[model samples]
Target: MEKTVMIDGKQVQFKSNGATPLKYKMQFRKDFFAEILKLHKLGKLKNLDEIDDDVLGTLDFEVFYNIAWTFAKTADSSLPDPETWLESFNEFPIFDFISELQEMIMANIQSKKK
Candidate 1:
């Protein structure tokens, strides 16, 4: 499944292949968890003992940037590297884009469950 949303005033399409390779999926999860752990170590995230989805969703721009860049790279290789791509933006709509992408991912998962 694929959907396009505006990010930094540019149209960016996020693609999800139901058949995504396990390696990429694993890497995404690994990196995500690592970021969370790093944040906890830095005392950036509250409740070190347990983090709920609500807390995860409230992560700052750094985490959002990493996830978004990873997702974008998986979706499109033709795009520039994360640093270059990020540099292109004067202001990033991180939360808005993440929300849209998250919805798209959930919708894709739901479709596949059938």
Candidate 2:
């Protein structure tokens, strides 16, 4: 799946290549589960209706950065690193972009389950 969002007055593109590779999955497992546990414990993710804007606002950028870097195929290929790439944006809609990414991943998982 693919999505385009305006960031820093530029149209940034993001894509999800279905299920992530096992290697990347394993690499991010601890951090992924940690975030999930943290959100659940904070009652920000117990259910769709329970998501709190305050809690979501506190989420770190690591998870989003990892996912974005793993899937980003920007036109400029000389960004040095993900951090630099992300930093290039003057105003990044982190929350909105991450939400879209999560939905893509969840949808992919659900489709495979059926």
Candidate 3:
């Protein structure tokens, strides 16, 4: 699956495909599915104030950026490293956009049964 979202007035394309997981693992040196599951805890919360400090303390917020970058990289092979790519954007409204990515991530993992 592919999506184009506007960030800081620029159109950014993100892709999730057969190679997405592998790209994520290779770039971040972390299991894509495992990292994704970590975000599930945040998804269950009614608000940030409701977070359990014990869990929030250990959460790597960078995972959010890494996941976004991985999908962006998958869409455009020539994109620079994550940091540089992110720097190009004046504002990256990740919180607003992550939910969209969550759906794409889920679709990537689902299998079509005939």
Q: TM per model?
A: 0.55, 0.56, 0.83
Top TM-score model: 3
Model 1 lDDT, residue 99, Cα: 52
What is candidate 2's lDDT per residue for 1-113, written digit by digit as tens? Answer: 77776767877766655344342365456543344333332322444456568766776656656656555643333445666777888777654455656655454444454
TM-score of 3: 0.83
lDDT (10s digit) by residue, model 1, range 6-97:
87788876665643334234644554444544333223332344546676666555655665665666678787766887898888855455
Clashes of each: 0, 0, 0
- Two-way TM-score contest, 1 vs 3, winner: 3
Model 2 spans with C-alpha error above 4 angstroms: 22-58, 74-79
lDDT of 2: 0.54
Q: CA shift at 91, candidate 1, in angstroms?
A: 1.1
Query: In model 3, which runs have C-alpha deviations exceeding 4 angstroms?
Result: 45-55, 111-114
In candidate 2, the residue pairs with backbone N, CA or C atoms under 3 Å apart (3 or more residues apart, or in different chains) clash, namely none
What is the lDDT of every predicted structure here? 0.57, 0.54, 0.83
